[model samples]
Target: MIELKDVYKTLDGRKILQGLNLHIREGETYVIIGRSGTGKSVTLKNIIGLMKPDSGEVNIMGQCINNMGKEESYALRQKMGVLFQSGALINWLNVEENVALPLVEHQRHLSKSEVQSIVQHKLELVELEHAGKRMPSELSGGMKKRAGLARAIVGNPKIILYDEPTSGLDPVMSNQINDLIISMQEKLGVTSICVTHDMSSAYRIANRIGMIYEGQIIEEGTADQIKNSQNPIVKQFISGSTVGPLTQ
Candidate 1:
């Protein structure tokens, strides 16, 4: 569903992506794990067209996003949902309104009832059914993330990109978020690209896992295969060791 081929990007005189290549199959969860400043977020930005690579191609759903018309780019983005690391909810809006914002902005053909129906379904999927009337300040961190997820899926997007879905939550809440991500995949069958450092979350949610290093993917495999990888960098990373090749 998505392919980044020989992608190279530089920001602020620093090369962030160098010959980065990735292929995400449709209807599968692909998790990317890497250290800080390893181009995980940069890769996502390239895919979303927030930043174009200095060189190489980003193709989504068989179309090159690197060279698309305004209307075309906008249309392509509408098919994808993104859950930012911070949830990025509107502080002024209630949960229901936040969830309905996408439909309100796009899909103008839908009536109030239709929008409400979709919002309700998405909120329920995120397990925030009764919190619709609550404000952002009234929610816990997990609730905020869930609400953000509800807003993301309200439009029934074909792909979901999660940035640190399990970050800053207690173990229980983190597991809940992980399960919710898995639920979204199973229930909606959407292609998922999750970028996280949490190994537990990555192992649980990913059908395929890739590790990025020096701005490119150095390893890609199934969860177990990644867990059992022999590469020194991959071994040091997954083991959380400080004295291996990564640290050396």
Candidate 2:
């Protein structure tokens, strides 16, 4: 449902993505794993049109995002949701209001009752039915992530992009988040693309995994394939070894 072809992006004369290419199929959980500064998040931004590549094409569901008009871009974006690394929740807004913000902003025609119904359902899906009145500051890290997740799916998006969804959480909480991601995929059938360096999380949630290195996708396969990959860079990364091609 998403494709990035021959993509190249640079920032301040530093190339972050060089001829990067990736494809994510429909109804599948695709995870992109890489060390810091390897363009995993950059690739996600390119997909969502938050950042355009200096050169190359980013296509979502057959339309080139880089070439879309304002209305077209808005329509396209309505089909996608993003859960950022930090949850990106507005501290002042309560969980219910935060989850309803997308509907309030993009779907203004809906009545307050309708919006509340949608928000309530999303919160329930995330198992935070009683946290609606709570503020972001009042929630635990896991709860914050769940709140962010509720906001993301409140729009009923066809695609979900997760940026480090399990970051900073304990092992148990991380596993819970991973389970939630898988649940969303199975229950909603949304195409998912997760950008993270957490190998365990990736292995838990991804139907397919792509290893990115030096701004290009060097390996793409199932978890078992990735584990058995012979590429030195991939091995070094997945094995968490320091004595390989990847320099410290």
Candidate 3:
């Protein structure tokens, strides 16, 4: 559903992505693993149309987004949802209003009843139906993430981008978030691209995995293939080793 071909991008004279190539299929959860500053966020930005590569193409849902006009780009981005690491909930709005913000902004044609119906369904999907009346400060870390997920899917987006979905949560809550990511794939049939440093969460949620190094994807495969990979960089990162190619 998405492809980045021979993409090269530089920011402020520093090359962040160099000849980076990636492909993700429909209805699959693809996880990207790498050390910090390895262009994971850069790749996500390119996919979301926030940043354009100086060279190479970003294809999403059949359109070459690199060349789209302003209106076209805005329309295209409506099909995407991003769950940032912080959950990014609005501090002022209650959970329900936060979840309904997308519809309020982009889908203003809908009636109040329709908006409420969508908000309610999304809350239930994320298992936060009863918490809709609560404020962001009132929620626990995991609850906030689930509410954010609800907001992301409220518009029924085709692709969901997860940025450290389990960050700042305990293991039990992390597992819950992982399960929700898997469930989103199975139930909503949406393409997912997740970038995270948590190997355990990556193993749990990814149908396929790729490891990025020095701007390009050095390895790509199924979760098991990635787990069993013999590449020194992959092994060292996954093992949490102190001494390896990455450290050197």
Candidate 4:
């Protein structure tokens, strides 16, 4: 389980997260939706310990990560995986090598062949086994995202964080990524937290959706509740309307 309690963050005198409280159960897909610059991506960074909240606690798997030492934090990180918006693949490395990078760095006990096998398995999981020898530039946008997904799960992490997974893709490619996410979750049963502005993707894959506005989670519920919510902010956001509390 992951929990954030009264989390507050500020950078250069600007508040990004304010008293953000959230709980995500294991083996569940939680999607966070918000307009641009609403601190959606910042929340993911805080969860992964890449950014520290100015106040409040970030607890992952019952451990207060904010107070953990470097060694402890490193150990905790091994249990989590992150898929950045751009895939963040190494330009010089082949697909398999990119996926195996995490395992090679963290699990030194595994021989080269073992790492390769693990890489192959993860690639197969993302339906990209044949593209293992291809570079990031050689793959299409969807393919690159799949490669990134393959790399994210190479270690069989308990939790996976996706930051704008469908950002720059067309609607078709976006849906394909959503289907892949749903399939992978069912196959592996990993806890997923996806931060995206794509409501269609959220409705398709998320078991529960949280709407963030002005640095706070103003509404959260099942997809149906979000769709029917009478809350002005929620309605406005779902409809993509420029007129609402958010625009003020």
How many clashing pairs per prediction, in order?
0, 0, 0, 0
- Candidate 4's error at 4, in angstroms? 0.4
Deviation from truth (RMSD, Å), model 4: 0.9
Tens digits of per-residue lDDT, candidate 3, 1-248, equal: 99999999988888889999999999999999999998999999999999998999999999999989999999999999999999999999999999999999999999999999999999999999999999999999999999999999999999999999998999999999999999999899999999999999999999999999999999999878988999999999989999999988
Predict model 1's lDDT versus the native: 0.94
lDDT by residue for model 2 over 1-248, one digit each (tens)?
A: 99999999999888999999998999999999988998988898899888888989999999999878889888999999999998999999999999999999989999999999999989989999999999998999999999999999999999999999999999999999999999999999999999988899999999999988899999999999999999999999998898988975
lDDT of 1 by residue, 1-248 (tens): 99999999989999889999999999999999999999999998888888888999999999999888889999999999999998999999999999999999998999999999999999999999999999999999999999999998998899999999888999999999999999999999999999999999999999999999998999999999999999999999999999898887
Residue pairs in steric clash, candidate 1?
none
Deviation in angstroms for 40 in model 2? 0.7
Q: Deviation in angstroms for 116 in model 4?
A: 1.1
Candidate 2: segments with Cα more than 4 A from true spot? none
Candidate 3 wrongly placed segments (more than 4 Å): none
Assess each prediction's global lDDT (C-alpha) against the native.
0.94, 0.94, 0.95, 0.91
lDDT of 4 at 64: 93
